[model samples]
Target: MAAQQSQGIQTLLEAEKEAAKIVQQARQYRVQKLKDARSEASKEIEEYKKAKEQEFKAFEASHAGTTSTTQAALDKETDAKLKEIEALFQSKKKDVVNTLLQRATQVQPELNRNLKKLQA
Candidate 1:
């Protein structure tokens, strides 16, 4: 009777070990599935973003020739260009002022360093 009881206990331990192994495998599978799902979701989100960007680009291209919005955009762009031109003039304003001053004073001001460098 004691030997039979020991055998039963051994069998129970073996069964428990197998159950534990199955549980561990199930946990691993669940983790892998979750990772796969998250990766898929991330890929889908990126695809959605790309699709939205393309749609927006298409809409913008289609509307670029429309009168109302196009004119406003053109006006804004024109203003930007004008501002750039104004900035360029401002940047060269000192040179222009110096040249004008020398002409008015009838004195040859020192030659421009940049011009001398360029000539050399």
Candidate 2:
């Protein structure tokens, strides 16, 4: 019937409008959250970096040799520790990546389940 077809179109149009509104609102919320997260992350990073630099400068100043002997001793120890940390990081980085990949593989089934539920 002509009337039925018109009514179906009207219903479909209204459903589309509602879906559009929901999608627009969700997009706006996501944009706001992303901006807020970025701002917070930048602020925290700036504070941390500033604090670390200040700490290092203070330490260097306090240790500011009345003598070259103390300065050389500090420099040597710092260099050795830094090299040790770098080697440790190089060895562990591959293990960290492998662990992440293994975890992702384990979660594949759960991800599929969630996708199925969302589609249903």
Candidate 3:
């Protein structure tokens, strides 16, 4: 009976050691799996970020082209309007100067005649 008890104790110790070894192996596997998952997620995030950056850059480039074309058209219209105004000013300037000169010459002769009569 004593020998039987000693054999039972040895069997129980072996079983406990095997259970501890299995638990340790499971913990190591879980840690390695978590590390792998984190690595995959980080890679995917970086790829998504790069794709978004490229998309935004393309959008900005298109917007800039549209803006430049619109600005050029607006500038052309402004230049045409300025030219028309300049032409109108040039065309009217000669007539205005000639009329003023004629009026001044006619009025001066009458004023001198009146002054001579008053002196006499």
Residue 86 Cα positional deviation in candidate 2, in Å, after optimal superposition:
46
Query: What C-alpha lDDT do the candidate models reach, one value each?
Result: 0.96, 0.93, 0.96
The per-candidate count of clashes, in order, stands at 0, 0, 0
Model 2: per-residue Cα lDDT at residue 14:
100
User: How close to the true structure is residue 117 of candidate 1, measured as C-alpha lDDT?
Assistant: 98
Clashes of 3: 0
Please give, for residues 32-102, the per-residue lDDT of candidate 2 as tens digits: 99999999999999999999999999988777764577788889999999999999999999999999999
**Residue pairs in candidate 1 whose N, alpha carbon or C atoms collide under 3 angstroms:** none
**Residue 70 displacement (Å), model 3:** 3.4
Off by over 4 Å in 3: 71-120
> Can you write out model 3's per-residue Cα lDDT over 25-75, one digit (the tens) per residue?
999999999999999999999999999999999999989989999999999
Model 2, runs deviating above 4 Å: 66-120
Lowest lDDT 10-residue stretch of candidate 1: 61-70
Superior candidate under TM-score, 1 versus 3: 3
Instruction: Extract clashing residue pairs from model 3.
Output: none
